[model samples]
Target: MNHDSYPDSYIRGILNTVKTIAMVGASEKENRPSYFAFKYLLERGYTMIPVNPLRAGEQILGRHIYARLSDVPVPIDMVDIFRSSRHALPIVQEALTLNPRPQVIWMQLSIRNDEAAALAEAGGMKVVMNRCPKIEYGRLSSEIAWMGVNTRTISARKAAASGGIQRLSLNRASVPGGATEAAAAAERMERERGSAG
Candidate 1:
């Protein structure tokens, strides 16, 4: 699997325009990454349909959980996959069977299936492998307030006053907790600033 994979401008355009997502391998466990990611996207106003065979017919984050992508009733703009690479092909195949077909297929961090990604791409779907939507949302959106700096909040004025280091390394791995939230918030903030400015 290529760890250097990235989505093109066309794929990014699709992700930006999509409002609905079907999350495959979404879990009911509160502590799981998929659970938090699903919740985050939902909180951000995106419609999220959770797909998990183990939790089919159950409710997660106020949305009905389906056993498979084809079971989702509404149209899906994207499919965020949390399953392993070995299991991604079938899911891609399933997503392809949708009426309108999904605009994007995203494989989570550490998950990459080239064959599946190629299949999706060949079928006119954007493919992103070994990437996390949450991370991309934060990075591309600029929700992080002080990415490299140690400070939690810094205004533009303050940045000017401090002679702006131009960068700060939070060494997130060193932070005890809230790393993901911090990153997401910073990314969101940055995106807002970019659009506003």
Candidate 2:
């Protein structure tokens, strides 16, 4: 089956509900996409557990590295696979064995396996193939649009207001305040992205 696209609501719902994610194929190298993407999620208020069998017992971004998904002590809401397409099948297989299996299995950009995706879906886990969570989050949250990138979401809501402060949050809303506050949110995102890199 072709998985060239997914329902926005499905992806959004997953992002809204998931809190803890187990990132497989995590890398220690700061320049690696996995490294920064993991940090991006961390800064977005999600707990990211790095998983790399080769780096087991080591720490990545202050999180303990697990050798496998099953090795993670806590339940995982999602499994973010940074590995290639060929490994998706095995990875999903392992994810299914967890006591409380993850609700989602996400293969990174350039990664896709119909069989793996189908199996996970059959097991009641949502599957996202050939996509990057970092990109998805930024897109869904309209963070990229703020950078003058055409997000194609024209029906935009204003940013939310709280405690007399305006900031971009996960919820749908327009930019709350004036230039200063919008700049603040943008700067924060860039800083976190830079540091993660």
Number of the top candidate by lDDT?
Answer: 2
Clashing pairs in 2: 157-173, 157-174, 158-173, 158-174, 159-173, 159-174, 159-175
- Candidate 1 C-alpha lDDT tens digits along 1-197: 23243333333465567889999999989999999899877765689999999999998978999999988889999999988778989999999999989988988776767789889988998777666776555443334433643322223322212112333222121212233576556555543443343
Those runs of model 2 whose alpha carbons end farther than 4 Å from true positions after fitting are 161-167, 173-197
Using TM-score, give the best candidate's number: 2
Question: TM-score per candidate, in order?
Answer: 0.71, 0.82
lDDT (tens digit, per residue) of candidate 2 on 1-197 = 34656655667778989999999999989999999899988887899999999999999889999999988999999999998777889999999898898999998876777789999999999988777898778776677666775443433566444232222455664332233455446545543443343
Angstrom error of the Cα, residue 132, model 2: value is 0.8
Worst 10 residues of 1 by lDDT: 168-177
Q: For model 1, state the Cα shift of residue 121 in Å.
A: 0.9
Residue-level lDDT for 156 in candidate 1: 30
4 Cα displacement, candidate 2 (Å): 1.4
